[model samples]
Target: MTIATHIPLPQPLASLRRRAPGTVAGVDWALLSDSEARRLREFGLDEGVEVELLHAGRFGSGPVAARIGRMTVTFRRHIARAIHVQPV
Candidate 1:
C-alpha cells in the first residue's frame, strides 16, 4: 500500500483576501448556521462547489466578492469567516 500525505486543512473564507483572484476553493458547511447555510446554498455556495474571490469591498475590509459557479455573490466579513474553504 502507498502512503498518503499532505492533506490541506480548510481555511476561513475571510482569509481569501490574501489569495489572488481566480483562486478556486470549496466551502465547508459544517461551520455555518442552518439559515445562513441555507441562504448560501440558495446562492450556490454549497460544499464542494468552486468559488473564486473576485474582489474585496473598498474601505475597512467590508464585504467579499466571489464567483460561485456562474453567479457572483458577496458576503460580510464575519459571515465569510464562519465559512471554511479548501483550495480546489
Candidate 2:
C-alpha cells in the first residue's frame, strides 16, 4: 500500500483557451480571458479601456474593431466572447 498526500487539484472547468487571431465589430469592454486580461492591462484594455464600434462585417458577425489603450484590435464573435471586457 502507498500513502497519499492531500493536494488541491487544478480546476479544469475554469481554464480558458488561448486567444486566436480574429476580428470583432464592436467588442464591448466586458469580455476577456485571464491571459488576455493580463495582456490588456498594459494596453488600457483593462477596466478603463475605451470602446467604440468602428464598423460591422456585412453579416453583422463582424470583424468588430475597438480602440484600447493606444492600439486598435479586431476580433470575431467566437473569439470576442472568449475575451471578457469591462466598462470604464
Candidate 3:
C-alpha cells in the first residue's frame, strides 16, 4: 500500500523577512475577510505580483514593510502571513 502525502506550498510573505524578495504566489482568500481581501486586491497585492521585503517594524515581528509593484505597502504580521510567496 502506498501512503499519499501532500507537498507543502510556498511559505508566507511574512516569513520572507530578512530574506531576498519574492513573487506573490497567491493569497489565502479564505483567511481574509471579504473587505480586507478586496482592499488588498485594490492595492495590487493579488497573485503574480512581485514583492520585496524592505524591512520589519521597530518592534520584533511587527508590521512588515514590502515593495509591491511600484508601491511600498506595510502590512501587519498577520496580514503578511496570509500572502503566499515564492522566494526569488
> Which candidate achieves the best lDDT against the true structure?
3
TM-score of 3: 0.79
Q: Global lDDT for candidate 2?
A: 0.42
Would you estimate the TM-scores of all the predictions? 0.65, 0.39, 0.79
lDDT of each: 0.67, 0.42, 0.83
Q: Give a tens-digit lDDT track for model 1, residues 1-88.
A: 9998885666766666443432225455676678877898688665677666677666647998777778878887767776667754
lDDT of 3: 0.83
Give the worst 10-residue stretch by lDDT in candidate 3: 6-15
lDDT of 2 by residue, 67-88 (tens): 4435667655544455444322
- The C-alpha stretches of model 3 lying farther than 4 A from their native spots are 1-9, 58-60
lDDT of 2 at 33: 61
Angstrom error at residue 54, model 1 = 1.4
Candidate 3 lDDT tens digits, 7-82: 5457888777564778888899898888889889899887788898887766557898889888888888888889
Best by TM-score: 3
RMSD of 3: 4.5
